[model samples]
Target: MKKILLTVFAITFFINAKAQSAEVAITKKENDTGKIYTSVEKAPQFPGGIQSFYHYLAATIVYPVDARTKNRQGRVIITMTIEKDGSLTDIKVVRGVSPSIDQEAVRAMSACPKWIPATQNGLPVRVLYTVPIAFTLGK
Candidate 1:
């Protein structure tokens, strides 16, 4: 019975992992500029840390009035270029929930302070970062 339970748990974990991988299709942008990289040796860090960044977003983000009124809720994925100077540029919506929510996500990201830029071989490089912002209505 112990062996059977362990096998079942392993199978369930594998299946769940596969399902999650299938749900998120990440297409890394391919470019030959030698300036922008999808994956670098060292990735950028948000001000303070990722947790602090989330807290900042939660505190600063204002849900769209139209989206709240329409009862629309989903995750909005935003892609932006973290420049070599720790500045963000080319902000865009990779996968948007709705127009209002999408706009808000972009707004929130745009308002972010500079980040610690990514590095490759001890040199700063522009890198692409994708962030998912979720919008949910209150109870």
Candidate 2:
């Protein structure tokens, strides 16, 4: 009976440790002057929320003619810093399928309007945000 109890306690401790570790996996970065967080108390948002953001992307992203002709299709991953004033900067492609498509993705993201800006401890803060844009050719 004592052995069984010990084993159960050990299992519970490990389970709790695993859960805490998962929670700690959220990315956060800080600096002396300006801090950039990937996970914050409140995330930056588009003016009209996520659906509107997608709509904006759809309306803005024009498939590159060269890429379409070359049958280039894939998702382009982009990362940008959302400033305290909700402006986006440091826009770049983390992953790309082709040059034209990559450039188009950057163009679309760069043209987006200001976001709501992320918050930490109830004050506006800059955050690094990543977005993936997909380019698919119709069948």
Candidate 3:
């Protein structure tokens, strides 16, 4: 049927678009640095450390009203690259529960303070970090 064909086309288009975007990001990072690393010898960290990072998230995020009304609760896994300058870039939701929730996660990440840049061989390096933002309704 026409509807089925359209659906298939849409899915294919979306997949291709995502792949292209990812490729572009990878290419840009490689050009900026020699390589992108998932983990470095000294991984990036919030100024105050892990505990403070969690506290910052808890303080910063404002739950989306639509998601709260729908009772949608889950973790949104976000992937971002920490640049050698300690700033975050290329933030994207790797696993998203809902649009509103996902947007909120990205917003929080964008507002994050600079981290202590990751290091390899005692030199700063760009690192890819994945974090999960949990959305739970307060009963």
Cα displacement (angstroms), candidate 1, residue 77, comes to: 0.6
Each model's backbone clash number = 0, 0, 0
Cα lDDT of model 2 by residue, 101-121, tens digit: 999989988899999988777
Clashing pairs in 3: none
What TM-score would each prediction reach against the true structure?
0.75, 0.77, 0.78
Relative to the true structure, candidate 3 reaches a TM of: 0.78
In model 2, the runs with Cα more than 4 Å from the true position are 1-33
| Candidate 1 C-alpha error for residue 105, in Å | 0.5
Whole-model alpha-carbon lDDT for candidate 3:
0.72
In the range 72-129, model 3's lDDT, one tens digit per residue, is 9877888898888999999999999999999999999999999998777788877778
Backbone clash pairs for candidate 1 read none
Clashing residue pairs, candidate 2? Answer: none
Query: Worst 10-residue stretch by lDDT in candidate 3?
Result: 13-22
lDDT of 1 by residue, 22-126 (tens): 123233444654456666667788879765676667766787888878899877778898888888988999889999889988998898999998777788877
Query: Which regions of candidate 1 are displaced past 4 Å?
Result: 1-34
At residue 54, candidate 1 shows an lDDT of 60
